[model samples]
Structures are given as structure tokens and as C-alpha cells.
Target: MIKKLFLLVILCSLQVAVAQELSCTVIVNSDQVNQTNKQIFKTLEKSLNDYVNQTKWTNRTFSVKERIECSMMITINKYENSAFSGTIQVQSNRPVFNSTYQSPVFNYQDKRFTFNYVEFAPLYFNPNVFESNLTSVITYYVYIILGIDADTFVKEGGTPYFKQAQNIVNLSQGSGYAGWQQTDGNRTRWELVDNLLSNTFKEYRLALYNYHRLGLDNLVDNASLAKQSIAGSMKLFDKLNNVRPNSFVLQAFFDAKSEEIANVFSDGPKVDIVKLKETLNEIAPLYSDTWSRIKY
Candidate 1:
């Protein structure tokens, strides 16, 4: 029994030493690429998965169960020589407290991804320098996912991670990458991080903490009070919408949250849905159809 305990302690220590923060699944869809050989795509999918899941992106320790759950769907719409153009759908979710339910924290699609990749090339991330487009782009989203997840637990706790993503954006500004520049379009990586760190959009960050920590996490204990807190958190967006109407982060929040929000109030112990729906509509007018369905 003593020997078994010693072995278990050693195993736990080993896991602590090697536990990376992200549990990412990567899928590279190259159906649009007219390549006959499919070995390269398979290699890319594995490389990306290994790269993201193996890299220790932060100083914080995460057990296997605590690692952030996320996925990157890389759809290569065009490929020629070593150049590849694609869109990446990045998503992440956090487990609600006292329940098995996983709440969607981020669901965003980056459309301006264009990178060059050689099969079997090693992917490495450096904070101070602009690595290749493939490395930088994926790293940016990784930090964004980490940042938003942190924000859900603590007010503006994601600042450090968001700043890491900002560093990548600043370093990659002139690298000719489509998503790293201001002119890369409104939905580029540059804009996303900028908006996140900018003081003008702090409400969205605070609301994230309130919604999860103060609301969803308490649902099992007090469903009605939790729904009220969630509604109160949603009202924060109304203030943000008035200051910066129809912002990217606002849209990003609803993109992940609309369905969940609708369902949360629809079947709960009950709250003022009329006011909650108004707040939802005010902040995310695009999700009006979703808001209209919220009852009780």
C-alpha cells in the first residue's frame, strides 16, 4: 500500500510537470484544394493539433480536467505551391459550476487567414517575435480563448493574455499577413484584440465575469436569482452598445451566447423576461429572433 501511494504521488507530479493549458482539437479541411494527394492535409491536421495541445501557453498549471477546451477548424479554400488561404472557426467552452453543462465562451470565425505551410514543418511560438503566419495566427486565437475564459471567472482577469495576443498583433503588423493589420478588415485579429484591451469595451469583459461567476455558476442553487443576475449582466451590454453600437466583441459574445441565453430564461424558475428580452434586443439587435423566444 505504501509503494502504491508513492507511485501515485510520482504520477501526479509527472502530470503536474507536463500539463499544458489548452486541450485543442484541430481539423484541417482541404476539400476545396484541388490536390490529389491527401497526405499533406492529414499531416497538417496532426501538426496543428500537436502544436496547440503540447505548447505551454501560460504560467498557470492546469490538470487534464482543468485545461481549456477549444477547437480550430481550418478550412483551406485555396492552395497553390506553399501558399494557403483559409478561414478558421475558433471555439471554446467552459464547464458550468456544479453541473455537467458546458457553456460556450467563444465562437468566432476568422475569414482573412492566409498562410504558407510546408508539410512536416515544426510549429513554434515566440512572444517577442513574429513567427510564420501559421504560428502567429493560431497563437493569437489561443491567447484570445484563454483571455475570454479567464474573464468569465474574474473581472478583467484576462488582461495579461489579451496583452499577449496584442504583442503578436503588434509584431505582425507589417508581416503582410492579412489578419494582423488594421487594413485587414474590421474582423481581423488586430481589431479583436484591440477591442478587447481597449477601455471602451470593458463592459463586455466585466459582464462575462458576472454572467458566469455570479449567474450561471449559481444556477443549481438558486435558479431564479441566477437568472436575474444573468439578466442584470446582459444589461451591461446595453451600456456598451450605446457607447459603441454593434461592436465586434458584442457580436462575438452573442454569437456564442444567444442560444444559451434564450434557453436559460425560457425554462428556468422564472424572471422578468420582458425586461430581459428588451436588454438582449438592445445589446444584440441581430439576435432579436433569439431574444423574442425567451419566456418566463
Candidate 2:
């Protein structure tokens, strides 16, 4: 019995040591709702916190420090009985190579988040099954975060994970959810992942890999070359824009990267400044003011 107990302890320790891929901070805000049963919100918060942090969403093993840092803020707009409706804001960041700074990879908001929650009920998610909209939506974004992080490491490394997210969308076709359908809007979850994985957007994904792994990661060793590599990657966005103008994916990229891109070129070689400004205007004309701020 002593030996069996020791073995069980070791197994438990091993399980605990294998950290999940995401170190997500989940917040359940109920300020919009006028309710006396605030305890349910507290319970929901704890449950979601556990669901996101404790569940293993990928096959890769990550150390506590290596886990991807992300946050999901779900603001409750309405709460009636066990039903909750709200919006979710999600943001994720990846650490730069050999630097203390982290770069934002994904920042998005889901304005239509409606679901039913039972107090103290378990939040279950299975990629093969379409369970609840809450779990499905959360799982979808989790995979998206993973996919974006993966792309920064290797060229198209996020393809498999994006496909996984696409599968969730496909399975959720009959889910009657707002964000799952293409007709919902161009910025819907379906369009985001679909554009990311589609051939028309291949250059954009390639640019992501180059911008991170080849450009940012090499900045410490060679700033000029890194800037040039990053510039080359930026040009690909122009190509992507030519193919699919005003794409949701392109807008999303700028949403997370505009500031960083501007800063990176603010004091670079004079030639790069001209090229970057022209490309920035051509591809992301929406951010011309931001790009114009870059020092020539």
C-alpha cells in the first residue's frame, strides 16, 4: 500500500508539471446586469478560470514560463436566470527573442456572445463535438491564439492549428450561433480563420513568419538586416491586399501591429523609411496617419 501510494503521488506530480499551452486570464464581469445573485458570477468566474488555465489544448508541453500569455474579458450585458449575453475581448502576446518585451499577436472582440450557464456546472469542450456556444467560442479563440503564436515560430506553422479551429467552425454549423456563420459579417470568427488559412492569404501568413522569426528575432544580432527582412515581409501584405482588398485578416494584423511597425521604422535607414511608408500607405491606407508619424 505504501508503494502504491508513492506511485500515485508521482503520477499526480507529473500531471501537474505538464503545463497547458495557454496561460489565459479569464474575467467574467457582471456590472451590466442588475442582479442580487452576484454569487453566480463569482462562481462563473472561477469555473471559467479553471476551464481555460487547467485544460490542455495542445499536444506540446510548455513550461510555466513558456506558456502563451493571453487574456479573455467577457462582459455580461444581460443575465436572466441561467442565460448570459455579453461581449468578449481577447488579446494575446508573444515574447520577442532575447528581449524582455512581448509583442501583441492577436487582439479581437466578439460583440455577440450569448450562452447559457448553470451555476457550478462544469465547462466542457471537445473539438470533435459541438457542445455549448460558450465552450465552442472559447475553444475557437484558444486555437486561434495557438495558431497565431505557432506562425511566428515557423512559416505556416499555425496551419494545423488553424485547421483545427476551422473544424470547430464546421462542426458548429448547426449550432445556430451568431459568430459561426459567414453571413454574420466579414469580421465574424468564420471569416477570420477562413481568411487566415485560405490560399489568397498565404502571403500574409508567410509575412507573419518572416516578420517574427527572421526579423524581430534577428534584431539583436543585426538591426539593419532585421529591418530589411521585416520590410520584405511587409511588402507581402501589399500583395495580399491586391488579391483581397480590405480583408478582415489584414485589418486584424494592423490592429495588433500598427504601433510596433511604426516604431520599428521610426529611426531605421532612410531608404527603408521611404519604402515602409509607401508600402504602409498602399496596403494599410487606414493607418496612414500612424505610418506618417514614422521619422524619415
Best by TM-score: 1
List per-prediction Cα lDDT, in the order shown: 0.90, 0.89
Model 2's number of clashes is 0
Give the per-residue lDDT of model 1 (tens digit) for 1-296. Answer: 99999999999999977899988899999999889998988998999999999988889988888888899999999998889998999999998999989899999999888898899988887778877899999999999999999999989999999999999999999887788888867877888999999999988888899899999999999888888888888888888889999899999999999999988988948787778877888888888998888765
Model 2 agreement with the true structure over 103-139: per-residue lDDT tens digits: 9988888898999989989999877889899888898
Candidate 2 wrongly placed segments (more than 4 Å):
1-17, 268-271
